[model samples]
Target: MAEKEEYVKLIGSWASPFSRRVEMALKLKGVPYDYSDEDYLVTKSPLLLQLNPIYKKVPVFVHKGKVLLESHLILEYIDQTWTRNPILPQDPYGKAMARFWAKFVDEQVTLIGFRSLVKSEEIDVAIKEAQELITYLEKEITGKMFFGGETIGFLDIVVGSMIPFCLVRGWEGMGIDMIPKEKFPELNRWIEKIKEIEIVRECIPNREKNIEHMMKIVGRIKAASKTA
Candidate 1:
């Protein structure tokens, strides 16, 4: 008896780091998947709504007709299912730490960093808070070539996916350098190393175009703040 063929599909937005991380994981595992580019800012597609009625967000992973929500969860599913080019660490302790850091990146770093960029009145305080959270990452990544040690892993995918927006170009578009070379040497080095990977490079959106789109979003937020 032969095994059934699996169908994998990923619905995601071009600019979403969460979406990119899931895509990167699939690519790393060499899983073939159909991709649907969703522009939810304009309108959410019927399929997206049908698949994820609760959040209706992109980066929804569909494997053999079973739907999975949340990028981190999707990445883990892909890793466990494929069993090749492992994304998470093998050791229990290492795996736990990786999950912890990934959660930190999504919950703490991403939240404070975006607030710092858009909150003009509280920009100073927000930046300080953002930097404080980032300092923890800087220390965590010290003495390592990658978060996974020698190669990109779960934590690397989570943090690296946000590099364009949180660490480098996105901050640059807002006239700020969040990760200075002098201040964060290890992080800067890790950024360069991760960007050199073919999969990471492919997952990254075009630099100029991404910055333009982000600036437009920032403009809208600022305008809304003025009205409110």
Candidate 2:
């Protein structure tokens, strides 16, 4: 948190869900800032390299001359700094639960589930793991409009950003319906509701492009498997 006059910039990659998460957070908080899309494959900008030396990843948030890495951490910082349109819960217990789900969504859910969409020898197993995660969420999301209920909150942002990339619900990559309507009706309803949110829709990555990328990865893997 800087003083009265501080600059805020979001350096991101177009296809990155992590970047979109930060972007959505900034927009939701009504924070005015410039977005710089870095083509790391083509040209990793000097500014991005300097800001995030360790990871060299996009969605590097520069606020008041301070660099913040990790989308979830940046989100927490945004809520603390903005104080308006607060995304996190005010109560201690509620806040803790939100944080738990956010972390779980990122590490336990997205990390494993998204990889399954890329390229996997055991596609069935990968799909099963993702389905299990979704089923767990399906129960958690029951009766709640969003993860935070009536209003969108921290956990919702974390999980929602990755939904488009998630197999069944998103139809982005494999076009596999990982969370079937009958099996996970609640989660399906929630996904539709979240998609209608303007900010979320604006930040979501393109489905066709996402599917194309997954296809490329699978093709490459098939070629490599033949060679092996």
Candidate 3:
């Protein structure tokens, strides 16, 4: 643990992929802070509601009384504030490309992929869509060590958070193989490479644990639908 700095705080949920991304960035940068785990259901703190009225969600960062909402936005703030190790590239084109892929993950992979998980009937089409997205990533990252190359940059963190969750849920919900070595050799290789990083390996949630949680969530949804 780094020396406790002047009261940096993160309000997030335990299993949120968004929260995990921020946490991983903080850990990687050796930022010392306090973490408050928020409940998505039942209750949300007044402070949380105030900071993020729009989303009314967790994964909010408060640094020295200034609040930041959204995981990607928070990540950019963190990198810019701390000059120690910049997460994004200095080159304009590189930065633009990074931003583009990050947006792709947020728009397509996270939103669409997660929606597909909760409704199993949509799994087949979702799997196909996700494969096409993965194919784009596989093509984009032909010879890079990280998504941003050597040093894992903004895009890496953004996209990396989704991979494990997507893998587990896609397999469990749809019984589809997304990262087969034979089909996506580059992607499979990259997945293995990213996991080798200490920050990623230590912070990423356990795949089995996530699958169990998702199963419980699915069961509840199914029960509610039957009753309705």
Best by lDDT: 1
Model 1, position 55: C-alpha lDDT score: 91
Ranking by lDDT: 1, 2, 3
Query: What lDDT does candidate 3 reach at residue 185?
Result: 89
lDDT (C-alpha, whole model) for all candidates: 0.85, 0.79, 0.78
Tens digit of per-residue lDDT, candidate 2, span 127-163: 7887888788898899899898789888888887766
Q: Write the per-residue lDDT of candidate 1 for residues 102-140, one digit (tens) a residue.
A: 999898888777777787687778778888898998999
Q: Is candidate 1 or candidate 2 better by lDDT?
A: 1
Candidate order, TM-score descending = 1, 2, 3
Q: Tell me the alpha-carbon RMSD of every candidate.
A: 1.9, 3.1, 3.1
**lDDT of model 3 at residue 114?**
55
Clashing pairs in 3: none
- List the candidate 2 regions with Cα displacement exceeding 4 Å: 1-4, 118-120, 165-172, 216-228
Checking candidate 2 for backbone clashes, the offending pairs are 168-177, 168-178
The whole-model C-alpha lDDT of candidate 2 against the native structure comes to 0.79
